[model samples]
Structures are given as structure tokens and as C-alpha cells.
Target: MLLGTPAAPADAAESSLFRGTRQFPETALWNDSADPAELVRSIGFGAVGATCNPVIAYTAISKHLDEWAPRIARIAAENPTWGESQIGWRAVEELSIQAAKLLEPAFQASGGRNGRLSVQTDPRLHRDADALVEQAVRFSLLAENIIVKIPATAVGIRAIEEATYRGVSINVTVSFTVPQAVQAAEAIERGLDRRAADGLPEREFGSVVTIMGGRLDDWLKQVASTQRLLIEPGYLDWAGVAALKRAYAIFQERGYRARVLSAAFRNGLQWSELLGGDLVVSPPFDWQLRINENELPVVRRIDVPVDERIIAELSKISDFCRAYEPDGMTVEEFDDFGATRATLRQFLDADAQLDALVRDILIPAP
Candidate 1:
């Protein structure tokens, strides 16, 4: 298999030699009701997933607001046991289902390895652990290759446990810190263990740690300009080598089922530039396009062969998202409407324990 080959056709299987770039346009997957299959086919992306939040949902649903009025009215007439929330869920459900359907053939061809749709669980349920589990179960029923997008919240961990028990595949989304990542690995093992004990099928489960490349760099730059930017001096958890080293060591240790999914990837000495990576999830539209055209120029696999000393340093830091729970919080007490950014902010400010973990336990494995 040559390194450079023409992009595979829509109905074709993902190329063995070429790793597919997953694209999230920093916006909606489709606009003005763009045809899902046609758009996916045209993009040449081997797999594409939709990450919806309050904003994206509104953006996608807004286009059909007037158009859906008739549909809404019909639904209202047929089943009065509904509100705007129900309508919205149904609409998103249909869209997600259709998108999954479009990729159904490819998913089958790959034996569920690729060609799938990742629909995010409600952001409103980010903290409600039980709600997340319920949501995962519900969404799982909607599609076979569905990857229930769960936030890396404490509650999300519980959701992962429950959902995995129910035989649903989950993507631990928004994993920024090491402890959060370690906990994700722990949760995955626990889930896998439970599945094994229950005599459930051992499906290919994955725990991906999302290292926000540019976001972390940007945040670091912002913090570096501050006074207590003192998280520096001692160990290296924030920068290029330090971060990648931490990722590699853990992925190689405690969690074989857990893989490092380089996310929110920035351009610097990140994966493509200096540090060679085994796998990366692509989001930048322009770069992926350039990559497709062979226009990016230098796309070498960056493998930073670090020595044991570097490994020891990374083993020290504990985790990311100090405000979040190590095991994650249960999302049962909160309602969907009550889950807000302000609450997330509060948890973050309060979770000083986790911050210490990142600085202590989660840096790297010695």
C-alpha cells in the first residue's frame, strides 16, 4: 500500500494505509439542511461525527423552525405528551439516526471499526450521572454504531459504567487533565470488568484521552502571564514534550484499552510538527483539506523517543480539571435546565483537590 493514494469513495472502506481525518468544522456538520450522505461523501472523510451543544442544536434546528412548525403541530396533535424539549430531541434523534444510517454500510464493512456517527449526550446532563447513563442507553437504541458522547465529568464516569454495562459504546469527551484521563482508564477497566463478570459480550471498547492541543497552549500562555503561573519551575506538565510524554507513558501503562486521542490539537511542536503520534483526531478543517490535497508539505509521524528521566517527570502530575471529581460526580440530583456553565465554573473553582493531582499523581508513569 503506497503512502499517497486517491481518497476512497463514499461507499468504500477506510484505507488501511491512510488514517482518516475526523472533521468537526468548528460549527455545524450541515447547514440549511445539507444532505448528510452527500456531504459526508463529498468531504472524503472516512468517518465524521456530530458534537452538538446548546448552540449547535439551536443552529441546526433554527433552519427548520418555520419549516418544522407544521411537523411540530402534527406531533402536538398526535401526542400531547410533549413539549419543546421532546420535539427538539425527536428532531435531533432523527438527524442523528439518518446520519448513522448513511454511514451504516461503511460501519458494517469495517465491522464497526470505522464509518460511524458520534452523537453527543445532552450537555444539560453533564453533571447528572444517572441522566447520562439513561441518555446513553436511549441513544444506543437509536443506532448500532452510535458513540454516545459523554463529557469527562464525574457523573460522566458513572454514566460510562452504566452504559458500558448495558453494552453501549461511549466516547469520554472533553478529557483535558491527566487524573481525569487516569480516572477514565479506571472507569473503562471497571466497566470492562463488570461486563466480563456479567457474562456480557466483550465488544471493542475504547477510552480516549482528549489532549486539547491549541486550547492548552492558549490557556498556558494566558496562565504564564499571571503571577501564580508557578505551576512551572518544578515539573513539566504544560508544554510540548512534557504533555506528549505524559500521554504516551500512561497509554502504555495502566490502560491498554485506553488510547491517547490527541484532541483540540494545536499546530506547534504538537503531533504533526515535532512529536510523532500513533493516532490523532482531526478537527481543523483547513489542515485536513490541505492534508487531503498533499498541500500541507510536511506530515511526518512525530515520535519523540523520550528517555526514562522524562518518563519519571510525567509520572508525577496528577490530573486535569481540578474542579471536576477524580471518580466523577453523580448527575442524579440536577435537572437538565439546572446544568449550566456557572455550575461547571463553581465545581472547577472548588475542585482544588484535582488540581493537586495533576501536579502530583497524573504527570506520567515511572
Candidate 2:
């Protein structure tokens, strides 16, 4: 049966693209939601895990604080000396803890492979290695299956290495290129080596390098017109896919321990190209609903080469070129790349927004 072809009634269960994708060792859904009900719904749809970020946490508390009132009240009561930011951080972590509990069964069943929930440390700490490590340690203590999400910045990479040394599972986010992905994986390996040297057991680390695909395409589209780059109708949105394909190739070549997570997908095509790869696709909840309703032919393109002409054209733009090269850029270059910088800035903005919301919650003016 072709990937996009509809399955017959008798074969529906067996031929479901989502279900079939899950059968692959690499394919698992990390539902990107902080709402418990949404998370439970994702679980019902066979999501193996979930992820929470500052934006999601802010939305949850701003819109559903009543649902989490008891937990928030407990946290507030326990730390009377704490301020709004502290309370906000705890509130976000609490949401993740609750979601992690829902996923704990899968974690046990998968032997640490699935059933994990990720909680991102403060984005403001992205450049502070020591702070990131301290926060990550505390977050890991919340649950055995909880994965600490760290930004894939130079300092964040250092934090990831240290966290790995401490046996904390990490999910490195905002990785948009092959160089960033390679660096993140190398950092994890160094941490594992350090752990082994210290006589610590080489525990099975559950980590992921998240490559933001849709955002890359969005960024490229904005610059394509200015650069006068010839982007074919078919290739306009393929930059992210091409970048991901290259990153996946390097991951396999080096046998990196962390899985590559294809995130921020714009459409079903992106999902189709990346199916059956040794990676996780953390599609938004809405995308999951769309995938369930549509008949999608499964297409695996990890092995397929990105068009040489397109690569050559993109190479004219240094930033785009750098993204496609594995380890071609230094740590500083990777951190300062236009897309990387913009993503980090956006994350900090989200954190600030969350901080404002927390202030309203804790220090409401009369």
C-alpha cells in the first residue's frame, strides 16, 4: 500500500500511518502541551511522551490556574519568602510534574525509551551554565522520567554536558542546523565519558536534539526574496527538511546517543519525508488532530539526497549554508548565527511574558 493511500476497514488498525510510525523504534510522539486534559487526549492517541515550555506553562497558569490551585497554593505556602518569579517557576514545574506522572507508566514500559516529559529551564539562564545545571538538577529530581530541556547554545551545551555527567537526561532545544546538532551530541558524549571515568554506571540516557524545521523555512522565506535566491515552488519549504536530513545522516554516521527530534513541522509533507527515521516528531496538538483525519502516505526521505542545485543556491547565503554543514561552524559561530540568535531572543521574550503573568498572579495590584 502506498503511504498516502487509505487503508481498508479491516486493515485500518494495522495500517494507520500514525500507529505504523509508532512501530518504528525511532518514531514516538512527544505531545507539545501543558494542559493535563490535552495531555491525556494525546496519550489516548498513543503519544509516548509530552513536552512543556515557558509559553505553554504561561498559558496553562493564565487560563487554567484554578485547575492547579491546590498545587500552586501548596508551593506558595511552603515558600513564604519566595517572590513572583520563584512561584512562577515552581508553578511551571508543577505542571510538568503532573504531566510526567501521566507518562510514568510509558516510561516504565519503554524501559526509559518513551514516556518522558520535558521541562525547560528558565530561558534567561540560557547563557548561564552554572544556573542551568542547578536548575536542571532540581528539575530532574521532580520525576525519574523528566527530561530537562536546555537551549542548544554554547553555554547551554556546557550545561548539557554537566547535566549528563550528573546523570540527568536532557532535551537540547532550538537546534536548527547540522553543526548545532553535532555539537550538542558531542557534548552529551563527553558527559557520558566523564561519568564513566568517575566509576558511575553508564546509565541509558534519554536525550533529544530538537531541530526546529518549520521556523527555518519561515526564516528562509523572509530572506529568499531579499537575497534573490532562486527557490523553486517545490523547494521553497524544503530548506528545513534538507537541513534535518543532513543532521540525521551525521547522527547515524557518528552513532550519537541522543535522538534527533524533528519539531515545529509546518505541514504533512514535512512529516511524510521524515517518517521511519531514528527521530521523534513533536507535532503540535492541532497537527496531531489533522494527521488523524487525513490519509497520508508514509514517505521516508532520510536516505534521499537533497537536490545539489538547491544546496548550491542556498550556499550563497552564509547563514543558510552554515546550517547545512555538519560541524563546519565553531561554537561561537553556531551560537551567533542569525536563526540561532533570533530563536534565543524569542525564548527570552516568552520568559519575560511569563514573568509578567506571574507578577499578576502573586502581586496583583488593588
Candidate 3:
């Protein structure tokens, strides 16, 4: 147990749908928000873990301003020398730490493999491997179950290995393709090997790699519209599903240690299609509520391959090819991928917005 962290509450009874979904131990449900209230409810639904980014942090803080606003003011006053970015990140840290406590029951029960709260490193440090490693290490220290998220870009790959070697369980984020996932996994392997060579213990490092499948779907739709391609109906929705299935297949074949986590929910297929694999499907809290309301049966469809005709059509797009095939992209090209660019921009924007939120508390408008 981590010092100063409260003991986790006893496990709540799982909802019927979530209880049924637990038939496959390999498959698990994780909440994608860091809000404690949402996480409390999600735990009742059998959510084993949670993840957070700048956007999630901003959203949670905004939603609970009555509670967080005073906290932010106190943080600002306590750290008067700190800037908005620093103060904002301090709040993010506190938010993450609080959420991590709620998962302690699962973390302890799973021996640290299942119960985790993923906190992303600063997006602006994507290019600086050293800074990314520094922040990743610091975030990992926030709590015993904290998993740090780093991007899968060129420099990020370097930092992933270094951070992993230093004993931080990493969640590879901002990745959308097979190549990014494979490369990130290989980097993790190297880090683990280095730790073993140095006689360091590798226990409790439940690392995961995230593939934002919905974002891929959105990018392909944009590509089809701009290029004026006459695409068949509903084929676009399957792009992310197809990529996720392919990535899972490869991970199974290769026996990669890091589990594949499907994120960036755009549709129900993102949840329904990727079940039954030794992977994670992290839908937002709202998405989980909707899934429960729809009463979708917990079906095992992870190995169910996408239809060949759809793959053939999607393969026509070079970007889709880059994402689908394992060798389609190199580490050098990861930073330039369309999906990578779009996600990094959004994360950076969220960072700015978080800073602005702190500014509002520190320097109010006249």
C-alpha cells in the first residue's frame, strides 16, 4: 500500500451487465475519466481502472468547480512563485491522486496489474525525450497504481523505453496505427530487459498501450470527404474496429507483455467489437452509462475479423494502409501521421485551456 493514500473501499457489487461481461478475465472495463464522482459510479459498474489527459482534467475540474475552485485558489496562494501551467498541473496531480485512491481495492486485489489510473505527461514535452522521462517518473510516484501516459511519436518512443527502464509503468498514447503500437511495445520490452539485466524487480508494472481507434475513424472520414471518394455506406465506421482487431491479433501472435487498450470512443462498435481479447476498452463515463442503458449483451467478438471487402476498400486509402499494416510506418514517420498531428494539437490546446483556467483563478478579468 502507498503511504499517505487512503485504503480503498470494499468492492461494490458489479452491475448485471458488467458482471456478465467479466466472463472473460482477459477483457476488462476501465473508466476514461478522472472525476472521482464518475469513477465512484463506474466502480459500481465494474470499472477496474481509469485514464486522464489534459482535456479530462480540465473537464473534471470545470464540472466540480465548486469543490476545485477553492482548491485552485489555495494552490495558487501556496505556490505563489509558480506559473499557471505549474499550478494547473499541481491541480491535475491532486485530481489524479484522489482518483487513484479509489482504485486501490482493485489494485491490491489484482496485485497491481488491474487497478490503475493513467495520468498523461505534459503534451508540450512530446519532442523532448528527457523532459518526458522526467515527468513520467514524477507522475509514477504520485501513487502506487499510477500509470504514466506518453505519446508514441519519434522522441516519445525513446522516452517510453527510458521511463520504463526507470520503473514507471507507461501507457503509450497518441498512437493510432499498428506500427506505433508495435514500436512502443518493443521499446517497453527493451526497457524491461534493461531492468532485468540490472537486477531490478519488474513486479507491479502493469503497462498498457492505447490505440485511439475513434480518432482514426474521424480522420478517415475527413480524408474521404476532402478527396471526394464515393465510399460505400457504413464502411467508414469499421476503420478503427479493423485496426484494433489487427493490432490485437499481432499482440497475441507476438505475446507482447503490454496489453492493447482501445480508446477514443466514437461509436458502439468501439465497445462491442473489441470484447473478449486480453485488452482494455476504455470508454468515457457517459459512454459506459449509455452502453448500460442500451443493455448490449457482453459478447466475445475480439477475434471476429472484419469483412474482407471492407478491408480491401479501406486499404485503398494510403493513410489507412499506414495504420493497418505493421510495417507501413517507421518510427521516424510517427510524428507526421495525420492522426498523431491532430491528437497532439488537441492535447496541447487542452494544456493551454488548463493554464487559462488557473489564470482565471489567479488573475481575474476586470
Candidate 4:
């Protein structure tokens, strides 16, 4: 096959790729949705955890409006002074709390490591470390198995350390590169060190730093198109995969306790390539369905390096360089990274949409 040609899909077979992943206990599967039905299905497929962000919370509420619409209205009624944003956030909390219950068994089974419901801090608070830390601490109290998500932005790095010091297990989000992952993990370590110095009671913390590899791929693709750089489209997919593999290797070499999680998956390579590592691979419910339906082979490929030719080609992109190297980006530049800006905007838009959803119920158009 040509280097640029897309690989053929796995043939359907009785074997389940998701179930097959179970053979490698170090590699855990987490469903990327909070919708109860999807989560329930995912749990059956060896998913020990799930996540809820503004977009995911919005989707979960939208999917079960029959149950949530009245709840939203009652929340507004109870807090007469509350606006759509407050009411909407309350709904997000309730949705996350409900999802957390489903993972309790696994939470107990994994010793507080795998069965976590990751709920992200409000993106609107991205700029304020104090606010982010406050909200993350509160989210941590929602459920024993809850892991708060703070972005990998400059302020978020501060918040992650503070939140961890406050005993909030964190799942760093909106991170798309090796530098972002390592820095976020270091911040977590700092927080843990501070807590220990204070002689705080020992507790299990399931902290993870997410490398949104697919989003990195997206930004590089956009850069390529805008720059008129002639490149193999397939090579672009490897960009994120390469970044993730590098970040995982660094985490191992440096002994960073925070697990490296691969998020924003675009292709099977993101999951397949990272198999057999002690990390998390969270794919959206749809991707999980597609992989299961195809029954892709479950092979240990985390140690398998990407083709050198593809890496060399992707390195030509300046942004890919920033993502692929540890010193590629500084904490200060994280907020302005193309992928960061794009993802934050999308998350903020989803938050605004959630407010609108609550508004319609609280103040219907006459």
C-alpha cells in the first residue's frame, strides 16, 4: 500500500476490540460520554469510566429533555434570582452526579484509579485561577469518584496545582502537546508535594493529563492547507499519534504519576497505537461503536514507533514542531496555541448553548 493510502478497516468478527483490550490491564478504556444510555452500553464493553464537559453535559441534558426540562425549570423557580448560566450549571452538576453513580462499582474495583467521572471546570473560568480552583474543589465534592478537569492553559496550570493541593483529583484537558502534558503533570506533582508537606491525610488521587492528539492533527491540517504546503493527508493523522507516543514515553522515563490520556481521537491509530501502555484512551461513544462494529485487532503497539518518514514530513509544520518537542511550547503560550483557542471556543459555545437551553424553559417566548 502507498504511504498515503488509508488503511483498510478491520473485518467484522466475533472478537471484540474493546473486550480484547482487557488483556492489557494497564491500558484502560473510558467512554467519552455522560449520557446514561451510552454509558451503560460502554460499561458493558469494558469501559470503567466516563467524562462530562460543557458539550457532553449539554448533550446528555438534550438527550433526556423529558426528564431534565422540568428539573431545569424547577431550579430556576427555586432560585428566583438565578439566571440561565447558574441554572444551567446546576443541571450540569446533576447530570454528572447521576453518571458518577454508575461507575461506583468500578471505582471501588480500581482502587480509585480507573472508574472516574471527569467533569470539566467551566471554560468561562479559564482566565481566573482562583475561580477555576474554587469550582474544581466544589466539583470534587459532587462524588467520591469524580475527577475535576482543568484546562492546560497558563491559569489552568496554576489551578491544577491548587486544586490538587486542595485534594481535588484532576484530569487536565484542552492539552494537545508533549510540553502541555509534562507541565500539567509537574504541576500536579507540585500540588501533591505541598499537600504532603502540610501533613494532610493520605487519599487516592486519580490525576490525568490529556493530550488532545486529534485536535493537534486538526490544527496542523489547517496550517498545512492555509500555508499551501503539499503533504500527504495520511501523514497528518500521524502527527497526534506521534505526539502522544512521545508524551507517554516521557511520562514513563520521568516517572510522572499522572497518567497520560489520549483524547479527541480521530482514527483507530490513536487507540491501537497506544495499546499496552499504562494510560487512558477515551473515545467518543460513536467511535467506540464503530471500532466494536469493525472488531479491529487488539495488538500491543504502544512501543511501536511511527514511520520515520511520516514524522519527518509532519515536522515541517511549525505548529507540529511545537507539539512534538517537549520544549516546543511554554506554559505561557498554551492559551494561544491554535488547538487551544479552537477547543476553548467550541467549549464556550457549548456553554452558551446550554444557557440558551435553560433560558427557553425559564422564559419562554410569548
**Per-structure clash totals for the candidates:** 25, 4, 0, 0
Number of clashing residue pairs, candidate 1: 25
Candidate 2 lDDT over 131-215, as tens digits, reads 9999999999999999989988889888999999998999988788888889999999999989889999866667888888887
Instruction: Indicate whether candidate 2 or candidate 4 has the larger lDDT.
Output: 4
Clashes by residue pair, model 4: none
Compare candidates 1 and 4 on TM-score and give the better one. 4
Candidates' C-alpha lDDT: 0.49, 0.78, 0.88, 0.88
Ordered from best to worst lDDT, the candidate numbers read 3, 4, 2, 1
Model 1 alpha-carbon drift over 4 Å, by segment: 1-43, 48-55, 62-81, 226-245, 265-280, 284-287, 290-294, 297-302, 305-366
Instruction: Give stretches of model 4 more than 4 Å off.
Output: 1-15
Better of 2 and 3 by lDDT: 3
TM-score, prediction 3: 0.95
The per-residue C-alpha lDDT of model 1 at residue 316 equals 34
Q: Which sections of candidate 2 miss by over 4 Å? A: 1-17, 22-25, 69-74, 228-230
Write one digit per residue (lDDT tens) for candidate 4, span 1-366: 211112522232333444555577788889898887888777766788887678888988988899999999989889999989999999888888988999999999989998999999999999999999999999999999999999999999999999999999999999999999999999999999999999987777978899989999999999999999988769999999999999999999999879999889899888889889999989898888777666677888999999999988988899999999999989999989999999999999999999999988877899
